[model samples]
Target: MPLPLYLLALAVFAMGTSEFMLAGLLPDIASDFGVTVGTAGVLTSAFAIGMIVGAPLVAALARDWPMRPTLLAFVVVFAVAHAAGALTTSFPILFATRVVAALANAGFLAVALTAAAGLVSPGNKGRALAVLLSGTTVATIAGVPGGAVLGTALGWRATFWAVAVLCLPAALGILKGIPAGRGGDEATGKPALRAELAQLARPRLILVMLLGALVNAATFGSLTFLAPVVTDTAGLDELWISVVLVLFGAGSFVGVTAAGRLSDRSSGPVIAVGGPLLLIGWPALAVLAHEPVALFILVFVQGALSFALGSTLITRVLYQAAGAPTMAGSYATAALNVGAAAGPVVGAATLGTEAGVLGPLWASGLLVAVALLIALPLHAVITASRNTEVQR
Candidate 1:
């Protein structure tokens, strides 16, 4: 609702493009460094791992710090990481930059989530989050494709340089837009690290975060290796990579838009329906990998289902951990990045085997199924409890 919310989204767009653009750059990166594609994928996992570790750590450190300057500092670090990455000569140097970039991304997202939910009333958190995430979905449509083209024409380093430039405006936006002090969620007292850790032991909260991690694992696991799936399994030209990615982004926009509206009202039901459909969709995508048209249609379908599922799961996690508003954001972010980290590992492992490019799809299907098995009954109980409350 506030100008800062939009600015946060703008910053997220630049970070997200850095994250997703790797899909298109993987082949080129691998070739440049004389490594296997699977090896190059370690960059994805490394980034996720950085986020997984950094989210909570950074959030805890910055809990009492002024939110605006903290956010701006992270953006500066992110931009510098990209500049270093663009100038990197070896894979190891580039890999270190990815880790640094991801750490900054994790810190920014943790603070932004807290700031976003704090901007609106209790009921609008979902929509607020959706607005924040819109930057990421929009990145798929425009930023990612643009990065791919840049990577294709001028070299992957150019895309990194462009990302660095993009971060400049985002940093300015943070400086201009964000308030001068800590937000509502960043309580004014001394840090309560113990209370935040206590939130981790709650059974329901743990389950919700697990669901978040699992769904994202499936979503990102498949996404991390999408280029190979497009070029190899689908038998499409290299040119089609951006097209399919755009389609996926378009579907994701629609999905997150709908989920933002529905989640506040019917999180349980929406999560219930979306999870199973995604579990089915992942396997279906694999089966039809050989068909170009099926590839196009299914990716969109997968994107919609995956993001809708992801958004709702995260919104639910936020609510579940809201008791510790001080650290809820860091925990939610860590949970999601846990999945982001693991997903690529699965994709990379499968790629190493006979599954090749198709391996990621199967891994995604398995991840979703596990996530659904855990989530379905929980939502069923939630739905019934809500119905009881209404009847009473």
Candidate 2:
């Protein structure tokens, strides 16, 4: 990978931290604003909603813009939004800031993926994406936990202030590392909205998007309620919660690294193996949740498989939407956010049932099964299409 790619990764790390750190800080935020925890939880949904709406819109508007400047602009705005969020006392203002920050974060990631892919050869596209995505994995491991610690020590506002400060290096890295005129073919003219939409409307592309969504839904559905399950079912102490989360994050890092390398050769085998692994892992997790040792092992395994599936799904989308790579990345972001947003709803609904704490794991398994069914046929269709093209 190039130096510039790592710069993009740094930006991704900062953005991802901002996106996820709120989960740990919600209680503090709610209390500060004189609201319930449930109301504060809406902040997470607001961020996802912003990503869903902003990604495609920003990608379309900036389709012809040079990648470096566009990325820089987004990071700067993201930093500013964090600062505003940190300073705001009113709940409504903080909510608005979250949405604005998410929009910037979405744009930054969409352009950064395109920029990273452009810096590498076609054969290394998967690896490039993996390296970029590792930032998010790292954020999960270090940034989220660190933010929680900071929020605990100095209040939630301090965490946001720290995030705003962290963005400086990422913005500086973007300005210095990314070269001018990289990404997109402005000389060829900006793609018409209809052309971009046509590319997105392909059957194979839609399937790929669905695959992305399902993978996220399955992973997050169970993960969203993991703490309760671990405590209620596994009989683990509250102190072990952070340890379990760390284990999951570590597994995600390893998974992304392996998936990146393997996906460079072909994504099909990775997905073929990973999908079934997820299918098995989730159900096993449900049954094993009461066993502390087994629960720990299963959580790690599930996290690894989920992230591995995500990497391949992105690679598959990039391959399927070759004509509109930037838009493809944006759409992929939107699809994943859609899943992230939906997963909690599904998990919460399942939790309300008699199935109790283990319901989320079982629900996640069913979602994975549906995804695998869709994936098997979609892979066959994509393979057949490629074979036909090769024969010509």
Candidate 3:
């Protein structure tokens, strides 16, 4: 991987920490703002909404704009937003900052994907992306937990300040390490925004993205409710929740690391294999939700399989939309976020209907099953598109 990819990953780490660490601080935020915890949770949804809307929009608007400056500007804005969030007194003001920060995070991510891909040779695009995504995985393991600890020790404001401080190093890294010029400047060719949009509209790309979304829906759905599973279902102590989260994160790190190496050659094959594993794994997890040892082990195993499959799908989407250069990465970001936003909703509904922790598992199973039904035939379609791209 190139230095720019690492720098982009660094930026992603800072942004990702803010994106997730808020979950642990919701109680503090709610208390400080005199709002319900559920209301404070809306900030997470705001971030997701921002990412979903801003990713493609920003990428399209900046399709031909210089990437380096745009990326730097996003980091600066993000840092400023965090700093404001840390210092603000008004809850509405804090809400506004989260939205602003999310917009910048989405824009930076979309552009960084393009820039990261551009930094590597065509064959190693998947590996480059994996390197970049590793930052997020590592953040899941380290940064989210770190934020929780910081908030516990020094209050939620300290967590915001810490995340704000992280952006400085990321901004410096991007300015120094990432190259000048548009994200498409180094690609085989840069298509106009219209052409890119047309390419993205293709059935092949849509199916690939939808499949990715469904996979993510399952992954995130189950994960969003895993705390209850660890406690009520597995009958474990509350302390084990953090351990379970870390184990899952560790598994994700391993999976994404392996996906980077394997995706270029066998993304389709990996999907074929891992896809079925996950589809079955979810239901099995629901059934095993009662056994602590099995629940723990399967959580780790499922995490590895889910991320391995998710990363492979992302690589495939990038490959399928590579013709769009600057626009390609947005498809993956938007699709995954759509799933991310939807997953918890589905899980929450099941719980509301008296499904308990097992509701999330059932939600995951149903999602993966639907994804499998769609992907079963599209496997050949994805291969055909990739072959077509290579032939071009």
TM per candidate comes to 0.95, 0.89, 0.90
Which candidate do you rate higher for TM-score, 2 or 3? 3
Per-residue lDDT of 48 in model 3: 71
Give the per-residue Cα lDDT of candidate 1 at 139: 92
Candidate 3 lDDT tens digits, 319-391: 8887788888888888777777677667767775667658878989999999989888767776554568645
Q: What is the overall TM-score of model 3 with all chains considered together?
A: 0.90
Instruction: Provide backbone clash counts, one per model.
Output: 0, 0, 0
TM-score of 1: 0.95
Report the backbone clash tally of model 1: 0
lDDT top scorer:
1
Could you give the candidate ranking by TM-score, starting with the highest? 1, 3, 2
Show pairs that collide, candidate 1: none
Off by over 4 Å in 1: 184-191, 380-392
Residues 307-390, candidate 2, lDDT per residue (tens digit)? Answer: 998877877676676667568678778877777767756776776689886787898999899998887866765433433422
RMSD of each: 2.6, 2.8, 2.6
The stretch of ten residues in a row with the least summed lDDT in candidate 2 is 383-392
Task: Give the lDDT ranking, best first.
Answer: 1, 3, 2
Q: Is candidate 1 or candidate 3 better by lDDT?
A: 1
